[model samples]
Target: MKVIKKMSMTMALIAASATAAFASGQQAEEISYYEPGASIESIVVDAAGKGQVGNWGLGNEYEVQALLTKYGQPTTYLSQAFDMDGFDDDSILLASAMTYNELGLVKNSYDGGYSYGEGVSYIDMNDEGVAMLEDNLFTTAAFAAENPETVKAFIYASMKGWAYACENPEEAAEIVFNYGSSVSPEHQAYMAEQVKKLVETDTMGNMVRDYGKMDEAAMAQTLELAKTYIKLEDSVAASALEAMSLEDVMDASYWEMAMGSSGAFSPEKSEVSIQLKWLPQSQFMGYYVALDKGFYEEVGLSVNIIPGGGDIGETTAVYTGQVDFGVTWVSNLIAANAGGMGLLEVAQVYQRSGLVLVYKTN
Candidate 1:
């Protein structure tokens, strides 16, 4: 594990020395980002040239906003209450589905049973170059400052859980399946297997030797996507683009503790809550593994894991202090920073982008 050299500056710098630095904002330094680790997670939007232009939404996900911007498609934001697969069967021209979740639903259609492999043309976000980071652990700058040790404990346990999941994907998938409410056993299992490729590799398909390490180049690219595609309602999300140095926004000091004390799990206690970006699934198998393995308890902490959904805003909950921590995408957090929320990336769980695009081959 590499040493994470964290700056000791506190959030007070925001109103004090940091204020001066922002006021004196000069020529921004050329950010030369590092691309390490390899993960296969990518979010892609499905496209079709053969059908009519009528379409609905990808549950109005904030992530869908980026895909929409990239594809330049007209859309209607609708409720998930409608059967997504029904729309597909009705010949909706273009739509988006997650590689881990929705795509599988269509592929293994409960009704018509049309598999994605039959007639679908898929566009991988990484292949299309509109990808963004997903499933990163974050906390407010103030929370990190006040609870550094707690943060480290959570990251440490989570890293262990991630290693376990990467090594034992089938078991990991079962864990996710048990957590399912609206999801299917087969789909959960499928997500578990596919998500393994994403969690174990980086955006460039390079093998990620370490879990929870930030990929600088990949993250920088993600910021660019947010600025261009996810700004929403004519908002540029400039703060995401003009973010402070990596050292300022990503606090890796906790990583050092987890990496150093590989065998010695903390027994001293604390309590915290982590709100995941989406519902309980293989995407967050690591966190669940940690909880199942008693890693959180071993770390001397009691953790409340909250599941998120399309309607749930992890950023808003975190900003309002609803949770001590939150799991969200890279763009979401950076844009939150732009909105003055001060959410900082503590650990990057998914080294690759999970965004994908699907289209008809005919």
Candidate 2:
């Protein structure tokens, strides 16, 4: 049986090859490694013939697909995402794991976990330069244009909530747990810790003090990836997707206004609703923190956070005016506007991509 180790920075650098063909603003792929006596070439060779990989559908799956395709390997999707049984049985060669969620289960011995410990290896999208931005705050362009004060107030309060969550992850986890976390208590705590890393770290592994500030370089890389991978059925939408500039999808002015203003604010809209990308968990602790910590109230806003995961997507909900703002990946926001939804991202939440591909070692 083969043993897998968790992706370690300590992995020995044996062989390395890089390409300049990736999106602009993306760092060159510096290194790829496996366990002792293993090379990236060997792993790709094995993966090519095996053709077994696992990922949830949509952007994350696309990220994995892009990476594997770059390696010249066949991408055979798994029936289920995050299937630990398949990972342990070698039925799946690579399984998608988000640092904040599925990775906790993969590493912890708690319920619904494999407890793989140091026996798993992973390929990081950030390192590979295929990373797409995740978890942004966005609304329709009309909403933002019509209600600048409301947008600024929301951003100010939300960034404060994220700051609190990052500083006190354990408490943030508990707070989210109280809000009906879908995962177990232990996993929730693990998620908070991991999410803190994502919020406070940049793709280049630099520590970021400011919360919710969009990194233009990272956004550019994300846009390039979205344009490369995302294909639209609507010909008009496809043309829009191809023609999308950074300005079409995001408005940094709102974030700038929020950051420049004093903590005091009077919102034009006193009450508003925002949608989450998924069910309650530490993945979205910042918003919960804002509500629980009275940051939203401080801004004179009553916020209703609608949980996501139904037929209606977050982008659609915001575009259709079901919510004033929504938390979604940057790619989703771009695709939404390209489809003529006119969504505009107000702030970026997760600074680094949390997606990784986990596999066992020989």
Best by lDDT: 2
Query: Residue 331: error of model 1 in Å?
Result: 1.0
Model 2: colliding residue pairs: 4-119, 4-120, 4-361, 5-118, 5-119, 5-120, 6-120
- Give candidate 2's total backbone clashes: 7
Q: Which run of 10 residues does model 1 get worst, by summed lDDT?
A: 26-35
**Reference-based lDDT, each prediction:** 0.65, 0.82
How high is the lDDT of residue 251 in model 2?
85
lDDT of 1: 0.65
RMSD (CA, Å), candidate 2 to true, equals 9.8
In angstroms, give how far residue 65 of model 1 lies from its true place.
Answer: 7.2
Residue 201, model 1: lDDT of: 83
Which residue segments of model 2 deviate by more than 4 Å? Answer: 1-37, 74-76, 310-312
Model 1 regions lying over 4 Å from their true place: 1-83, 109-114, 232-248, 263-269
lDDT of 2 by residue, 35-126 (tens): 64566546655654556667777655667767877777765577544356666655566677898777778878998778877777777888
